[model samples]
Target: GMADETILLADDDPMIVDPLALQLRREGFTVHIAVDGEDALAQARRVTPDVVLLDIMMPKKQGWEVCRELRAESDVPIIMLTARGEEMDRILGLELGADDYLTKPFSARELIARIRAVLRRVAMDSARQASPAAETASDDDVVQLGRVTVDRARYQVAVDGEPVHLSQREYSLLMALLDAQGAAVKRGDL
Candidate 1:
């Protein structure tokens, strides 16, 4: 839930930051405010906010610089707020890896919705990485050891196109063996 999530909001205008911070806090987010690019990077590294609401025009460091720097190091979702509603500005922001773009004077509802949507996309991506893949995979997902083929996504092994059933312990041991890259692993460690 958003209650457990934090947001790093970077903007120079107190008028924008104060009211938005209040609104976000009221919606149950832990909001961290940064007045400029330097502060934004510091707070972002320290707080590791789940999302960032970055103003396109900030002092100390421009929003474009902050966005580029942040994208280079982390995939934390970013929503850019820009007073310049030009198509070129929007394109440039998206090209820099912003998850979404918000024009200035945008509706509060739309801002909140964008935040929620970006968060949801991030969660879904994490889930995909955690979930095991299926046997039907591209060439990248399968590994062959002589006649035996391992389907990493499905956690399945087969030889000559026939499945090899393995117990839970067996599967775990197999994974451990695979991870060792042929190096001997101590039984005690397992």
Candidate 2:
């Protein structure tokens, strides 16, 4: 599974880049190196690596910019690496759609673990989206709420073609309540 992954490591420091690249390659990943933000963007557009390890501070563009730009074009997973361990930087990176964050002076083993986790999540999400089970519903799908119809597959609720927006948790709770066969359902049952 690791053999199918191409990871882009974008850092300006050669000392940091060299060792990490070697370790990632040793783990059977195809590694691509970029020294700065601009080069990172270029390499991403070229190779479209499965995952990107981005340094916060780099020339031409910063990590935040690269993250935003990449997110606008593709839903590729990003993990921001920063030397600063400030809370604000971590919050800001997550707000910019980075899937994970790592501080510098981190161990190669830890970095590898983080990479595996992010990649696994991405793979699981893609699998869920592609699975036909997500498109079809069982015969027990509908929940009667006095006069409402809920279709879980299309994530839609309608009362005679009028749409209602319900969060996933809300929908699940409502369905559980409706399925109680006229008996009261406890709050913890949700």
Candidate 3:
């Protein structure tokens, strides 16, 4: 529905990469494979894919390092794949700015669902940012939420200047709720 998205699949194993690429293609994604971290990074910069499916272990560059480097350059959504199932590994990946993670041996259906969820959130965020009303509220615009204040111009949110990072959806939802002026926001509104 969104222009037949492209995906970069980074894994060293042909067995894994081949089948995954085929499955993704059957589901309408144009897939590219990278056998190492350096190749993955290079391919990502070259193609500017809609999403990345990154495996944690590989020759030349590990997935975590690749994820860090990628985050430094772009905000493209990343979903990490790892054979390691430790809680710390998952936590570390998220801390490095991965959008999501899937362990090895995961079902294709679950992987697809995760990809769709991340893409939906990203699209929603993009739309909210591009809204005309949001564009008009340049610097010095203050949206008050009880004791909380969102300064649009400065891209800051605070309960008296203590900063917070609210997701685009959270910010939009908060604005919608405030605009209702204590009236009930129907489920359909969200």
Measured by TM-score, the strongest candidate is 2
How far in Å is the alpha carbon of 4 misplaced in model 3? 1.3
lDDT of 2 by residue, 72-155 (tens): 998889999999999999999999999999998899999999999999998776775585443223344554454687776576
Q: Scored by CA lDDT, what does every candidate get?
A: 0.86, 0.87, 0.86
Tens digits of per-residue lDDT, candidate 3, 16-134, equal 88888888888898898999999999999999999999999988999999999999999999999998897988999999999999998888888888988999988876876676445
TM-score of each predicted structure versus truth: 0.70, 0.74, 0.73
What are the candidates' C-alpha RMSDs? 10.2, 7.9, 8.6
TM-score of 3: 0.73
- List candidate 3 stretches off by more than 4 Å: 132-190
Instruction: Give the Cα-based TM-score of candidate 2 against the true structure.
Output: 0.74
Per-residue lDDT value at 125 in model 2: 67
TM-score head-to-head 1 vs 2, winner? 2
